[model samples]
Target: MNSETWQNLLHLESRDIVSNWFEKIHNRKLSARRAKEIISSARQGREYFRSASTASFAVRPLLAFYGVASLCRSLTLLHRWDAGEEGLKQGHGLETVAWSATLSGDLHLALASIYKLRIRTCGGLFSDLVTVTNSRTVWHVYDRAVPMPVDNKKQKLGQELCFLDILERLPDIGNTVSGGGNQKWIRLDDFIYSSEFGAEISVHGTPDHPVCIEYADAGFDLSKRNDPYNSSAEITVLKADENLFRKYLPQLIDTRVIRTMGGQPSPHLVSKFPQGSWFSQISITYMVSFIIGMLARYFPTHWSALMGGEKGDAIWPQINAAQMYIETALPELILEIVGNSIFDNKEL
Candidate 1:
């Protein structure tokens, strides 16, 4: 695509369109918490776009559209919630739940878009990807290049963190674990209250920022820690001979770390790279086309109501035009970005 086309694609109409729409809706139907979640998701999508813009050219369009699609999905969910609440107030419980499930599925697709973009950028390197758990924990050692799974529920969010701890200890580029595996395993009580490690392990930035493991010791405590993951106590192993520890790292990970206490791997673990393949590209194009068609056919009146109340009719034409472009032009652009041969032959 030329520079003009890129500019047009990035031209998200006017910033005021979404902001005004959100403000009007926030004042009208959404609760404070729900409004906040919607705004936060929108902000995250923008942040991801900003981050993607700084990335190399090969994956820029994928990342940029991933952000745009995320914002679109969030707005669609907001619309669904607004439409569903009327029925909800009228005693349609099942219908309300169904609407919420649809919203959840949209959230899943937003994540999937990001996951595909990341895979394109990183060639599916597990270490470079950040696995976002259903509980919202973002697990990754690297700061950038973090890839989240499309389906959060299937991720082994907690075990992945443990697995990262093991990876951090391994002999890699720039990592040097102090006592190797032989460092004395700190007691759970000792590690938690140890003013030393406590001072070292302070939380910084927002929860979305990468978790810092600096100056932290990993050892298993027999008692459980106060974490949502419900991980076992005494899970960290501190001290072992360097050579022996290095030799057994893979075995330890395979036998103890990757699986849950129940000894089953997370069924939702995202191990396959489905994006950029011919089938995946076609599927995404078709899905986007279908959604655009639906919006054009059914959503203009509803959107007009949301944007301008009962008298709002002006916004429908703009929406219709946008949907038309999405159906006719956006699919080809997306296929061009994602269906390229360069992305197909990449190895993790």
Candidate 2:
């Protein structure tokens, strides 16, 4: 953000600023306390977007901008609370966020749900429905035509796919793909693994049975070597104290190289995994698809737009073509913000 943008953002009149930053911005100044308030509020809004349950709101710049802030916030927590002989507890993630977020989403108060998710990340708030992860990897639950990496030489999307048909999109679920391998996405409804952290249907911890199988590799071992996964490896936990975490997690969506503390290791603790992942967001996409499907069934019309229909009647080929347009546009909109975080190649 430029100094000029800061001046404007620092003098907002309302908490929920409209989506006009691109066009309706200009030079401005405000009270020092007021500037501080806008700064704080901006961070709060940004954090809310990162773990928001619905993708609908995430695309909005105000909320989407905070994706990095939210990720760093959770990383801070995972680093801090992971200490002592008791072991690092799994923190509730996306699965639980959707339930709370949905209630708020109904009222367009997704911000509250974001706040709740932040609390959950830091162990301040939790859900009884599921267990969380000790090491959280930000998983982008998307497929096909993903935005190409900015720095990566390859910009073309290597795969062509229909997302909803290819792999189920789990909105309110959590899955950990640690102990790396070339597992090119597979159905994860029932597979399992264990860790050295806490374990449960709704908690984060090491799976008691640390047997890993690399689905992507031609030949891989599915056996436990160290008592816990990565126990023999030198993996560092960044955030390790909950008390220290509250100070940093709710940061603004501004670009800053925010990192938590690390450099500690203790004996291994065993955690278990009954299943690889779980969900909470009531699969609304299915309903959306169904409703659209039913509309086509009851209000059946314009089937002439079907592919290669140009030879017959050119009824609504353009509208049908837009379906392809949206499939590609959505991912780019999401990645633009996320990519901002992944790269530091430009001005920090």
Candidate 3:
């Protein structure tokens, strides 16, 4: 189909109609008891994290991790409705329908958590969901348009091409594809590979040859002190960007890249912590060590400034030894501040 036809078919009206139909069908399958169970589970998970916030620093990380895991489980259960035989009978493949529902559920839960955390971070997480969903949606349409292929590889390649075709047309929807616009687009691979933690993952692709998947208004510059907390800075993909994103969809689905970018490896896997022990304990310890190292390296001048003069040579050795001791101990006061500011999502 031509770009105009595709656009017409996937316009706002069509989206609303299909979305409403899906919602009604999905809602009809949800029993009141099931809804109650989901709500109760989510509430309990939130409460666990809330209580953990007040607990000792060593314990909060464990609680937060479990709380996030529980929330994920709850979302998965909620999306189970979309994968039912009913949807399959309606011409949607079980996997495709289920995956779309899962992404929607994840976005919903992430938004709720962002609000509850009172931290405006996680915009990258939000954009990632949108990119995946849009790419999958375009691919689904293309698959339906084409004849079925017996070979799995051919089917996959065809789907990728279909996804790219849609992305090339995104500029029609107001996305800035060529000239630099207000919206900043970043390749998914670039964003992940360049991240502090993500850099450790062995992934192919460079800053120039990034995966096709792109996120608009990603707000990647976390260095700005005020940006993380700016609620007004919402992350979203314009209809145009969605159209343009198809160009890179195939590269993004490459098995090697997919494997590398799949999930955040548990920090516990590399730590010296004993098996089954609280992972957050080690996390907080590392965080403490990082902070102490920073302070020891940078605070001497600040200390002298606060004291109105530099320390005399006679006291230098004593001061250095005290700094070393403080670095090793990583006092509770500093740990508390770090935990609150970074982990708890509170403003620094």
Candidate 4:
């Protein structure tokens, strides 16, 4: 999650570490040709990521976005190797729908304009990535302070949304989204399950954060606590009937499983908006990076105006944090998916 922890798995500077990872992929018993394709794509992705490390902020988004795209291709090759080289070559599956002008000399209005920047999915590499990953874009919103999941009936392709919608859902830059201070990710310490005793969990987070449990196709449920739980309270008990417990336990365990940079695998103690439909962490990073990269590459004047403080002083910080986090987090995510696909079965 952090740079130091991520570096242990992704050593861009050292060929040996990367080779060690490739060796694991090779051991997956994939055909020689498929293994070669996966490794080659992964190597290209790593190169882009490594190159982005030294680039200036002005151009870092472009490099980082390509890095992520390449890594995504590598993942597609791994999961959908049957698609073959040609199938994987689908172009970027996303397109910008509109860009609204907001330079009316009002800082707040300019900051709000990020929401006007919109994009939608068409069919291409990004779409293939989504398909292989088994994820879809959704309209995730807060309802009465709880994150609500949009029904599958409402889930549709080509769902256009403003950049702010995506940015607000990202935990890394949640604080910077329109300068609002809401925590989107909370620490999940432990979840204990017992056939006889039912389940109890230890969730550590501030009282202000949304730390609710969702289960049995029901909505968010603040755990049954005699006293209000806060950061100081480490555990909360949940009692479920045996029939429901047996039905949902497997799903619960499956979803919470998380792998680290190391060989050891662990289950997350708390669920992140458990069972809620939201963009995968990778998709958010990829899309946000694409937006920044577009501004840098296609709208040089606008990018310069924001970067040079000609406009958007209020909006600048969020953009800066987004770029910084993407640079730091993308590789970790790429490797996490790689490791899960080839090394183990944990997921994001």
Strongest candidate by lDDT: 4
* lDDT by residue for model 2 (1-348), tens: 223322343323233341122112222323344333434534553344333324442132223323322322322222222221133234321122233333232322431121122111122212211122111212222121111111111111111212221112221111122213222222211111122221111111212222112111212222222324445532211221223222111110100111113311111111111121222111112122222222233323222122224332322332223222222222222233323223311220
lDDT of 4 by residue, 1-348 (tens): 245644553453344544455456444345556556666776777777777778877777788788778777776766663555677646777788755453334654554476568778667877677666542221111111111121233224676666776656554453536665444434344454444555444444433344343432333223533335454464443445545444443221111123344433333222332233334556667788888887678766666667777645566777887787776666655665565544443222
Scored against the true structure, residue 331 in model 4 reaches a CA lDDT of 66
Candidate 1 lDDT over 1-348, as tens digits, reads 224444443322334443444444334545555545445545654565665547643334345445545443333334333432122122100111122233233433422221111101111111111221111111221121111112322322112111112222221111222213332111111111121222111121212221111112122112122433333322321222333222221110011112345543111111111221111222222233233333333334333343343432333333333333333333233223222211232211
Candidate 4 TM-score, true structure as reference: 0.66
Candidate 1: give its CA RMSD in angstroms.
Answer: 23.1
Candidate 1 lands at a TM-score of: 0.21
Worst ten in a row by lDDT for model 2: 250-259
Over 1-348, each residue of candidate 3 has an lDDT whose tens digit, in order, gives 123322332221233433343244344445554455445544554565465447543344345434433332333333345432222222101011122232233333422221111111122212221221222111111112111111112111101111112121221112332223332222221111211222111112222212112312221112111223355532221122222222211222111111233332111011111111111222222222222223233333332332343332222232233223222222221222222322233111
Cα RMSD to native, each candidate? 23.1, 21.0, 23.2, 8.1
**TM-scores for the candidates:** 0.21, 0.21, 0.25, 0.66
Weakest 10 consecutive residues, lDDT, candidate 4?
139-148
Cα lDDT for residue 2, candidate 4: 49
Ranking the candidates on TM-score from highest down gives: 4, 3, 1, 2
- Which candidate leads in TM-score? 4
Q: Whose TM-score is higher: candidate 2's or candidate 3's?
A: 3
Better of 1 and 4 by lDDT: 4
